[model samples]
Target: MARVSQEHLEARRRQIIQGAARCFSRDGFHGTSMQDIFRETGLSAGAVYRYFPGKEAIIAALANEVLTAVRGAFDDALAGPRPAWPDEIIAEALRRVDDVLLFPPALVIQVWSETFRDPRLAGILHGALIGMADAWAKVVASYQENGLMSADVPPAHVARVLLACAQGFLVQRALLGPLEVQVMSDGLRGLMSMGLRRPPEEEPGADAS
Candidate 1:
């Protein structure tokens, strides 16, 4: 009977997660096995099972971990000191979006592919998306009220559209030969600026239709 300190328990769990990440990144979720994780972590099967029920559980945990970090990063940007201008905030937002893409796209593809067949998994992914969108919508709505964003656009709809666009961009890149992510990201930043910025008033339409 060994009494493990809480710190040691957490360390062991983190070790398992690291091992799982390596295995999944190298071999993918379907290709990985419990024994592979055991070998990677140098942990007994029982010990690993004590922390996670199975492979699916491990994947779910990993997705949650990634999504939580992303949400936290966005919240931090929104809660930062007020920007001098709307473009500043929009630039920061685009930079954050690029940062989110730093993670391997395969991880997201794995989760979504599994979700179609697993109701529990689907629920987890759906809930995360909804929560993220809701939080973003609230922030966008606040900015709109402050005249930092377009008030005509519905916050929730804009949030959803942004997320959909980001996801689509990644998926397309994954399928289409690793398109230049940075260039695409910059273009999206420009698009955000163009849409959110109000044009300067013209003098008597300048005799143009």
Candidate 2:
């Protein structure tokens, strides 16, 4: 038997994932068949199976990829150079949140809808989401340490609240018409301001006493 190189295996895996994304995004998970994956990838049935043991494996792989991408984006946006004013940083981060809401991995919604019916899958999805949220909370904590966050607010709690608002906006728009994206952006900004920006001291450059 010819030994398959690691690079070749990874490439094949990526091809399968891209094909799965296309099928899942268009026909949805339940609607898509293994045949759809084969057709989308232009690979033989045997080759598809060689890459992914089953359809469920493909779906799970896709979900992991999306979660990684989302987490990476959040990290980059949060760690960017601090803005001159605290509000500016909040605004940029809020905009990034809106961008995430606008276009997310199809697998995210797929796994979320199916999780409740399947306990094992629900556990997997929940773990992945909670890990991402925890990573995001750390970034929020940085601002708090720098005194950029408001004195009265809890950084971790605020991170959770902002993430929830972003997710809710996405859910609403998915069920409704092409509503304004800025609505989510503005709402996120308001939440950040309430919990992040410190109140100005009576005197400029003086710490709140």
Q: Which candidate is the best by TM-score?
A: 1
lDDT of 1 by residue, 25-119 (tens): 67988899999999999999999999998888877876677667657655775777752232343344445544543445566677678888878
State each model's C-alpha RMSD to the native. Answer: 5.5, 6.9
Model 1 scores a TM of 0.75
Which 10-residue span in candidate 2 carries the lowest summed lDDT?
A: 83-92
Candidate 1's displacement at residue 131, Å, is 0.5
Q: Tell me model 1's lDDT, rounded to 2 decimals.
A: 0.71
Q: In model 2, where do residues sit more than 4 Å from their true spots?
A: 1-8, 77-107, 176-187, 190-209
Which digits, one per residue and each the tens of the lDDT, describe model 2 over residues 1-209?
Answer: 99999999898888888777778777888899998889988999998888687777776666556555556666666667852232343344445544432233344567678776767667777886687577657766776678776445665676676567656655675566454656655665675565434346654577655
- What is the lDDT for 63 in model 2? 55
User: How well does each candidate superpose onto the true structure, as a TM-score?
Assistant: 0.75, 0.67
The residue pairs in collision within model 2 are 150-196
Assess the local accuracy of residue 70 in candidate 1 as a C-alpha lDDT between 0 and 100: 54
* Model 1 poorest ten-residue lDDT run: 83-92
